[model samples]
Target: MQEALRLNKPVLAICRGMQILNVAMGGTLIQDILELWGGSIKHFREELPEHMPAHTVDLCGEKITEIMGKEKIDVNSFHHQAIDRLGTGLLCTGISPDKIIETVEAPGYFWVIGVQWHPELMFNYFEEQHNLFKSLVTKCLENMP
Candidate 1:
């Protein structure tokens, strides 16, 4: 992930990938959301439908708001770990109602976004989730020499 960022490659990290991306950028994770950061919303929803919107994420970043087409969006939650300290150069773009970091973006890169939710599973139900990939692909193509 660091290599991709250094190369200015578009990186769309989802679920555990978001955790990995954070660590790769010198940030830390909660390890377990329930154990460390207790909240009303359950971060690990293995029993629920993967495509179902588990909770809402309030967004702030201009890029994310534009991509999502709204200030808040429903997303599926499937992981227990979440970003604690933001990685170097990474901006906290989205947050759950419980205050868990839901989305992050590296401003220095062309398109480096890490989403805590499983957008891949929700794409069939949410157009905004699908647009995440479309945005990444569009950035990738734009960067190609």
Candidate 2:
């Protein structure tokens, strides 16, 4: 992820990938969401259906709101760790109802974005989620050598 960011490559990081992206860029993680940042929201919901909407993330970043084409989105959560201090050059784009970071983007990069939720599992059910994949592919194509 650090290399990709250095090379200005298009990236669509999800779940742990998002954590990796943040760490690669000098950001920190909460280690354990429930253990440290306990709240009404369940950050890790393995018992629930994988495709079910676990919670909603409010889009705040202008770039993300534009990419998602909405102010809010429903997402499934299945991770205990999340981005705490944002990485250098990265911006918080989305957040859960309980204020957990759900999505981030590196505005300096060509198309580097990360999401805490598993969009690959939710794309089939949500058109917006599917569009996330499409956007990455499109960015890759547009920047192809």
Candidate 3:
């Protein structure tokens, strides 16, 4: 990650990958949600009713909002870990209302975005999620020079 950052590469980190990015850059994690939230609130409802929406995330008015062009996005969650202390040069770009860090980015670098939710799972369910990948690819291509 540091190598990619040094090279000004575009990055799209998902779930644990996002957490790893944060830690690699000096961030802290919430560790365990069940203990923090004091309930059996399952982040991943893999067996839940199909009609139920998994979770929602609020996009901060910074990098993510600029890229996604939205204030809020409903996303699927399947992680127990989250960012607590933000890393150096990193800013929160999205969050769960419960204060869980859903996304972060270092605008100092080129096209670096991280999300706690799994956008890959929502690619077909939401066009915006697909657009996220398209945008990342475009940025990566543009930054290849």
Candidate 4:
């Protein structure tokens, strides 16, 4: 992440990748969800994987909302880990009702963005979700110097 940021490269981090970026940028994590939240609430079901539903997320009305053109988005939840302390130059742009950090961004810096859920997995099932990749491609193209 430091390398990418130093190079001014466009980045779209997903899941663990987002966590890595945050950690690299002097951020921290909750470590254990069950420990922090005080319960073994399964965020992802391994057996009935297909039972995943589109959950609502609150967009912080920043560049992310401008790019995606919406204040709310339906996304899939998978991981138990989440962003606790935001990184430098990073902004939390989306969250679940449970207050999980759903998305983050470094706006106006070559499309530096991240999402907690798996948009790639919902591509076939949701057009809006797939548009994220499409948007990233467009941003990458625009950022090319």
Q: By TM-score, how accurate is candidate 1?
A: 0.97
The residue-by-residue lDDT of candidate 2 on 1-145, one tens digit each, is 7788778889999999999999999999999988999968998999988888999999988767887899989999999999999988889988998899999988887898899999999898998899899999999999899
Relative to the true structure, how large is the alpha-carbon lDDT of every model? Answer: 0.90, 0.91, 0.80, 0.78
**Ordering by lDDT:** 2, 1, 3, 4
Native-to-model Cα distance after best TM-score fit, residue 81 in candidate 1, in Å: 0.7
- Assess the local accuracy of residue 115 in candidate 3 as a C-alpha lDDT between 0 and 100: 90
Give the per-residue lDDT digits (tens) of candidate 4, residues 17-116.
8998888888999786666854434445445444255467889846677766788887776777888998887889898777878899986577788888
Residue 138 of candidate 4: its Cα lDDT?
90
Error of 2 at 143 (Å): 1.0
**Clash-forming residue pairs, model 4:** none
Candidate 1 Cα lDDT to native: 0.90
Q: Write the per-residue lDDT of candidate 1 for residues 19-105, one digit (tens) a residue.
A: 999999999999888989887999888899989888999999888888889999999999888899988889999999999999998
Per residue, candidate 3 scores C-alpha lDDT tens digits across 6-122 of 787899999898988898888889888877764434676668543344777889747678767788888887877778898898899877767778888898987889998888877
Clashes (backbone N, CA, C under 3 Å), per candidate, total 0, 0, 0, 0
Task: Flag the better candidate by TM-score, 2 or 4.
Answer: 2
Worst 10-residue lDDT window for candidate 2 reads 60-69
Query: Which consecutive 10 residues in model 3 have the weakest lDDT in total?
Result: 44-53
